[model samples]
Target: MNPTQKMSLQAIDLVGPSQPLVSLIINNYNYAAFLAEAIDSCLNQTYPRIEVIVVDDGSQDGSPQIIESYGAKIIPVLKANGGQASAMNSGFSVSAGEIVIFLDADDYLIPNAVETIVARWQPETAQLHYRLTVVNTEGEAVGFCPSPGVQLATGTVWPILLKRGRYHSNVTSGNAFSRSALDKVLPIPETDFRIAADGYLVGAVPFWGSVAAIEEPLGCYRQHSSNAWSNSQSTEDPQKLVKRLRWALKHDLHRYYWIQHQAKALGHPTQENLGLRDYMHLIDRLASLRLDPEQHPFASDASAGIARKGIGAVWQQDCLSTGRKLALLGWFAIAGFMPSLFATPTIEWFLLPTSRPQFIQKTIRGIKSLRVA
Candidate 1:
C-alpha cells in the first residue's frame, strides 16, 4: 500500500460510533475456486472495520469448508439451494452493519473501495445515497456510466439494468449499500428471474436518496468459458441454443415489465424511456419470433412472409451500425427459425449518466473532497 493508503486506514480506524462500519456480504454458489481470492481482497482493504458474510447457496463443492478456513472474521451461512437472490436476502437479513455491501463470490473489491464509498454517503439531505464507481478487470478499464434522467436503485444494479453499460461493463460485484437503503428496500424477492433480477431490485429503490459516482477502479471481475451461460453459447446444438434463447426472451420481457412497473411506482412516466437501443432490440426480437413453425402452427406461408418483411424492415431502417445491423439481422434469422436467443444483457449499458457540466462540476467537487484529512 502507498503512504496515502496507510494514512487513510489510520484515519478510518479513528472514525467514531456515529459512523457505522460497512458490511461486505458475498453470495457464494459453488465457485469455490474463486471464493478465497474474493475474501482475501476484502481482507486486504485499506479501510478498517468491515465484517464479511458469506452465504453458501448449498454448494456441494465443499464451499462451506473453504469459508470456514477464515475462522471468525468471515461468517458463513449455509442454506438450501435458493439461487443468488435468496442468498442475498439471507445475507441481508443477518447483517448488522449500518452500511451493507454485496459482493459476488467470484469478484473482489479494490483496496479503498469502502473508504471511497463511505465518503460519498454523508449527504446532508438523505440517510442513504447511491454511489457509482468505475472499475477495471485485469488492469483494463471498463467504460460504463449511467446516462441522464436515469435514477439508481439501491446497492448496485449491475447484472440487471438497462443503462448498465454506462457504469462500466466489467464492474465487479462488491458494491456498498447504506443500511437505511436496505431497510427501505428489504426482502428483495427471490424470484426465478433467469437473468434480470438485479435490474428489478435497482429499479425498486426510491427516488428520495442521493446518487453519487466514484471514478476509480475498485475491483476485478474474472470471466471464463466455464460460466453458466458459456456452454450454452459454445454449441451448434439446436436444443442448447433454443434453451438459451428462451431464457433470454423470458428474462428481457420480465425486465421491461418491471422497468414500466418501477417508473410508475416512482410517479415517473413509464413511456419516457432512455434505452432506445434496448427497445429496438426488443422489437427486433419480437419480430423475429414470427417464423417459428412450432410457435405458429397454422398459416406457415403467412408466417414466413411476415418474417421476411420484418427482417427487411430492420435492414432498411439502419437503426444500428453496419455491424450491429448485420448482427441483428443474423439474430433475427436465428430467432425466426430457431426461436431462441432472446434475453437482456445480464450486464447492460442503457442510459449513460448525463455529462452536463453541472453534474460534472458537482462530481469533481465531491471527489476532490474525498482525500484523507
Candidate 2:
C-alpha cells in the first residue's frame, strides 16, 4: 500500500462511538474462491464500530467450510438454495446497524469505505450510491468506472424517476442503504429480483427520501467467468449478445414495475406504458427488435416506434449535455432507418464498451463532467 492510503487507514482506525454502527453484509453463493477475501476486507475495515455478515445461499462447494472457519470473526448464514434477493433478505434480517452496505462476495472494499460512506450520510438520505473500479481476476483495477456520471438532484427524486423510468446507477456492491429507508423498501420481491437484487434496491430506496452520491471508488468489483459481461466486440458472440439483450429487457421492466409500485404507494403519477419513456431501455428495445424480431417481447415495437419514443426521452434525460443528446438522436435515426446487417454493428459499437476503442472510453470520461452548457 502507498503512504497516502496507509495514513488514511490509520486515521479511521481511531474512530469511536460517535460514528454510527455500520453493518457490512457480504452476500455469497458458489463464490467460495472469492469469499474469504470479501470477508477479510470487511473485518479489517478501519472504521471500528461495525459488524460483518455473510449470507451463503446454499453453495454445494467449499463455501460452507470457509464460512465455518471464519467462526466468530463474522456472522454466518448458510441457508437452502435461494437467489441473490433471498440472500439479501436473509442478511438484512440479521443486520443491526444504522447504515447497511451489501457487498457482493466477489468485491472487496477500501479500508476506510464505511468511514467515507457514513460521513456522507444525512438524516433524510435513503441510500448512498458510489462509484467502483473494475478489477480483473488478479484483482487490479482496469481503469474503468461503472457509474454513468448522472447524479439525481438532491432530495426526493421520485418524480424524476417516474418521468425518466430510471436513473444511472451502479451494480450490487457499489451502494450503501439507510436502514430506516430499507425497512420501508426491502423484503425485495424474491421472484422478480432472483438474480439482480441491486436493481430493486437502487429503484425502491429513493422513494422514501433522498439518494446520496459518492464520486470515488470505495471498492473493487471483480469480473470473473461466472458473471463476466464483457464490452469487447471480438468476444461478443451473436448468441450471447442476444441472450444478454433479452435479460436486459426483463431486468429493465422489472425495475420499472417496482418503480411504478413505489410511486403509486406514495400517490405519485406513473407512466401509462411500461418503460416507454426510458432512454437506455429504448436502445435495448431497438437492438432486440433488429436482432430477434420474432422473439421480441414488444409486439408493436418497430425500430421507428422506439426511435420516436426515445427522442422524447433524450430531451427529458437528466444531467445530460446537448452534445450527448444530438449524438444520441443521430445514432437513433441511423439505426432506425438502416438495414439489419449494417444496423446491428452500428448499435453494437455504441452499446458495447469493449467494442469502443480506448480513446472513446476516455472521451466519455472526459465529457463526464459536462452539463447543459
Most accurate candidate by lDDT: 2
Relative to the true structure, candidate 1 reaches a TM of 0.61
**Using alpha carbons, what is the TM-score of model 2?**
0.88
lDDT of candidate 2 over 134-170, digit per residue (tens): 8877897775455444543456667777888777667
Reference-based TM-score of each model: 0.61, 0.88
Taking the tens digit of each residue's C-alpha lDDT, what string does model 1 give over 37-140?
A: 88987787777778888989899896898999999888789999888778888888888987777777766677887777777776421223233333333434
The segments of candidate 2 whose C-alpha lies over 4 angstroms from its true place after superposition are 1-16, 147-153, 228-234, 321-327, 353-373
Clashing pairs in 2: 231-354, 232-354
Top candidate when judged by TM-score against the true structure: 2
Q: How accurate is candidate 1 locally (lDDT)?
A: 0.54
Give candidate 2's whole-model lDDT.
0.82
